[model samples]
Target chain A: MTTSKPTVFIVDDDASVLKAVARLLRSAGFKNALFSSAQQFLDEHDSNASGCLVLDVAMPKMNGLALQQTLAAQNSELPIIFLTGNGDIPMSVRAIKQGAVDFLTKPVNDSDLISAIQNAIETNQTTRQARSKLHELQQRLATLTPREREVLSHVVSGKKNKQIALELGTVEKTIKVHRAHLMAKLQVRSLAELVKMSERLGIISSPLE
Target chain B: MNWITIVWPMMAASILTLALLHLVVWFKQRQQVAHLFFAIAALGVAVMSGMELIVMRSVSIPQVVLLMRWLHLPLLVVWIAIICYVRYYFNAGRLWLAWTACYLRIFALILSFTTGQNLFFSEITHLKQVAIFGGETISIAQGVLNPWYIVGPLSMVALVVFVVDASITLWHQGSDTARRRAIIFGCIAFFLLASVGHGVLVHTGLIHSPYLVSISFMPTLFAMSYELSYDVLHSAKLAERLQISIIKREQAELDMQTQRNALTHLSRVTLLGELSGSLAHELNQPLAAILSNAQAAQRFLAQENINLDEVRDILQDIVDEDKRAADIIQRLRLILKKADCQLQLLNVNEVVQDVLKLVRSDLKNRGVTVNSNLSNNIPVVTGDNVLIQQVLLNLMMNACDAVADAVSIEQRQIHIHTRWNGTAVQVAISDQGTGIVSDDIERVFEPFFTTKPQGMGLGLAICRTIIHSHKGQLWAENNNECGASFYFTLPAYSGETI
Candidate 1:
């Protein structure tokens, strides 16, 4: 897939690392955003932006993990890649569990850092697209009537028109009309598309399954 | 009778001999002013006694009067000398009282010489031979006492007042010798006063006896000599105690100093252990940068269009990074030096900066901001370079540790200041964390005294030891705003390089 220049947001309290990492990423043809502290990064944070955070695990005021949590809370799809001077298993485990892309220890290999940033940026783009698709599905779902919403849930759950009718205590002809209106509102054609839309809006189970 | 005559003369001679012996001691040690005065008083008593003995043997009234006229001279000398002895030995006595006694005795002496007849006896009735002690023929006087004879008693009263006042003062003020002085001087003075009264009454025929003032003074003289001997024994004992204590004090100080050296070494080792992680990170930074720059340079060189300026900048950074790495190691090596402390002239600010370089990584890791206000005119101090660096390292590391758990990064600040303070140069390190409690400020410098759970508690103690060894002082105080400040002062370099 073709991609534009991906920015690597490098946040470290150490001036040397901030400058060094920024330069390294720059030389590798990646756009760089540098911040001395996590707070400064948070101040200029773009929640909608798709990039990778090459953040120092240990920083003054707010650390990498804390920033990761804040971004996660705000539902930002920006992937974080942690860089630490000393890597403790528990800290890395926590950062990864909080949706961080990767955890690397300094003096990180240039190749490894570049790959992690690549992976993170790729992941961020995928996540951003998925989030936007889910948002579209939610907006479409919001337009459906109560009867149509029930009919859509039954349809995504592998129910036939007659079974949905029986479950909703409606006639099969009435269930068919409600299904058509919901599908049109969701802008989907095949049952597969309708099922996928329902999954994205979390009408049934997770989309991964 | 024979025993009495021999005892009286023998006692008089013994007092004179004791005084002369003490005079020899006083001559040997001129600081013993009291001994010399005692000798003079004793000699005067001996002279008066000898003349009194002659007056007792006189055959005619005129001959008795002739001896009596000379008697006041020795009496006056004895009185003056005794006052001086009391003043010096007891370290007491009012100056005015002493002067009054001396001047009155002098006036009495002059009156005795200038008067037409004897100062004590205006008319001598006859020389009545009496059978005195030891079957000695002593000529008793039958005379009408001169009204001016009251001068003798009055002078005696003044001498009595002076001695009594001195003894009382010594009793109140003297620490070790008060009791002894009060008893010895008080008893001797009272005895002398009674002797003077009895001698006067006997000479005027109120009692039928020869003049016995000399004999009376003999017992008191023996008592005074005994007191003097006791004083010698007491002082010798005191001198021995003083010498022993001085030696013991010196030995204790030496042991403390030795312990300090060992503890300082131990603390340095401990500090190295603590900083080892940050040191690795510090070294890794430069190493990583240098590697990256070299790679970058090689990549540029391989390119068709070579970027010479970029490659030059990259190579320059690598060189600088190499030096930075080497500088860290050099600082470490100097601090870890295992040798006896050597004194050298060092800029206080330079020492502090060197230490800060060593701990820069650690401070960054802990998110502590260090603010150093090194004065431009900071004077050089004479100290062991490595030891001073270690002191600063320990102090700065301690300050960093102190503020590690502060609520905010802004609160986690360590401030270092160095300035010239006239006679000395001072360095102060302050932290904005939990300040040392008032009671623990001094105790912080005691070995094995620690506030940290993981601390071996020898950092401050070792710092203090190192500073003290350099003839400097180290102390800690709580800051008004927050946390604690540790200060050390080193003597300024005085052109005398060690």
Candidate 2:
């Protein structure tokens, strides 16, 4: 994951704006991939790749908002940064609520744009890291027996071996074996590490954490 | 009774001549009043001649004269009809309207009936022998005039007044020189002279015998006929001249308006030329999008796992965007198209919007905010669309420049409002910029006059010209305190009445 190079994708309906922004991004020390429309970007998009998207809010056919919904439906984690020429308040609020990384008004200052792009890239990296961890956790879970799977869920829920035994109607010694085997197979050395992994994978959100 | 030999031929000739004159008027003009007068006169003469012959054959002299006196009633009725006919021929029926002359004819008929008892007519000497040119002796006694005789003169005076009133009406209505003086007025003069001859000669003691007045009738009647035909021909010529003058007036007004609009448009075109880079930028987006979409479609088709449906949609989008780019280009080109100026009709909103597009970036650069409220259902107005757009662009550009000059970014606002006027559309483009002084307002639309250092001053003048070409009006007025509002109006698609 660390070996992959990062790029900022720009999508705009206006060519002059597209060219101007593309030039600005290049000047700001960013590798930029350009698309004129959301559809065009989607057609050539590699959802698995880690990158930040710069999408214009107003566009023909498929706008930036619709593209966001499409990406969400596909569960793609490429963080989006919205760019709008006519930036109204309602649209900004709506975009931010829809999980947009940032909304920047056009003819934006160079420092402001670079900062937004950096934040988006960092967010995308975090999302990809979390998704990959989930994949790894799922792979580990596939090795578990039905009984072990049940014991694993209870154990993660702050259940002691004795509580697990009482809940599952099993002996303490048997519960101990299941816990030891689950911990080893899950590759978790501590309960805190396991909870953190689960939280990051979106399996659960602990109030205490 | 030599009455048949003496009176019948002459009565027949008079009646036939009256009928022929009426036929000429009717056939030439297709006028209805002439037909009416002809029927009444011809019938009156025929009936009176028949009664005279019948009375002479069967009745004694005194009784015959008594009965013959009543024949004057029908003849009086015919004479009154001639006055009405002549009045109508000159288009005078509506002066008093209400068919007042016909009512007067009825009064004359009733008076004619009462005239026998009243001695509306009487023989001065019962047995006077008068010599005839053909070596024949005839009892040609002159008839005495009575109170009923006053009706004929009174009717003539009223008729002459009716004609004089028409002439005055035409004068007040401002007819042309020839119509006011020569034809229409002359017609009244001729009619008054003849009417007075028949009306007042005997009562005023100007003539002893009616034969003296009778001699004037044939010549005057023919003269009146010729004068009326002349009036018709003259009216036709006057109407033609009026129609031409109206067109010329309109054209002159249009030319003046066009001059103003063209000046304004020229200024706008110059301003737009300066913002050509921004315009290119606006157009380039769709062009680039079209290219990118085309490239994407080509790549998808070339690939083994080509999504045909997606590619087709992409191609459709490419085409659509391409057309969009082309349309923008076309609209921009319209401003630049070395077009020969033409005038026609247009939806004002469409023209306004197109012109706005031409200068939108300049407005943005100047930080001027423009708000437009154009009624959707405004009637199609007649004007030159290109020139109209040119006018709007000029005005808007001027507003933007004025805003820049004032250096008030927050108040650099323009409002365009339109609504349907009853017979016109009122359009106002107001700007909150530095106001033009009261003294300068009137001179703003003059050709080659500009207050701005860079301005050609032709802007407002050209706006005026274009507005005038559309048969509209344009002017500049100061806002409440700080700005100027350019107001204009266009005539709606209503029709003209005759």
Best by TM-score: 1
The top-ranked prediction according to DockQ is 1
**Which one is best on lDDT?**
1
Over B1-498, each residue of candidate 1 has an lDDT whose tens digit, in order, gives 444456557767887898998899899989988778778878888887777766776787788888888888888777777777777776678899888888888888888878747888777888887776556667787777777888888888887888888778878875766878787778878888888889787876777665667776676666667777888898899999999999999999988877767767777878888989888987877776676666556655766788788877777777888898898888788777676778877888888777887787777777788999999887777888888888898888888888998877788899999888887888899999889989988999988899889998878877887788888999999999889999999988778748
DockQ, per model, reads 0.17, 0.03
What are the models' TM-scores? Answer: 0.58, 0.43
For model 2, the stretches where C-alpha displacement exceeds 4 angstroms are A1-209, B1-10, B13-277, B299-313, B329-356, B361-392, B403-446, B464-498
Per-structure clash totals for the candidates = 2, 16
DockQ score of the complex predicted as candidate 2: 0.03
Q: State the weakest 10-residue window (summed lDDT) of model 2 chain B.
A: B208-217
Off by over 4 Å in 1: A1-3, A139-181, A205-209, B1-263, B298-306, B373-377, B406-411, B419-424, B432-434, B452-456, B480-482, B494-498
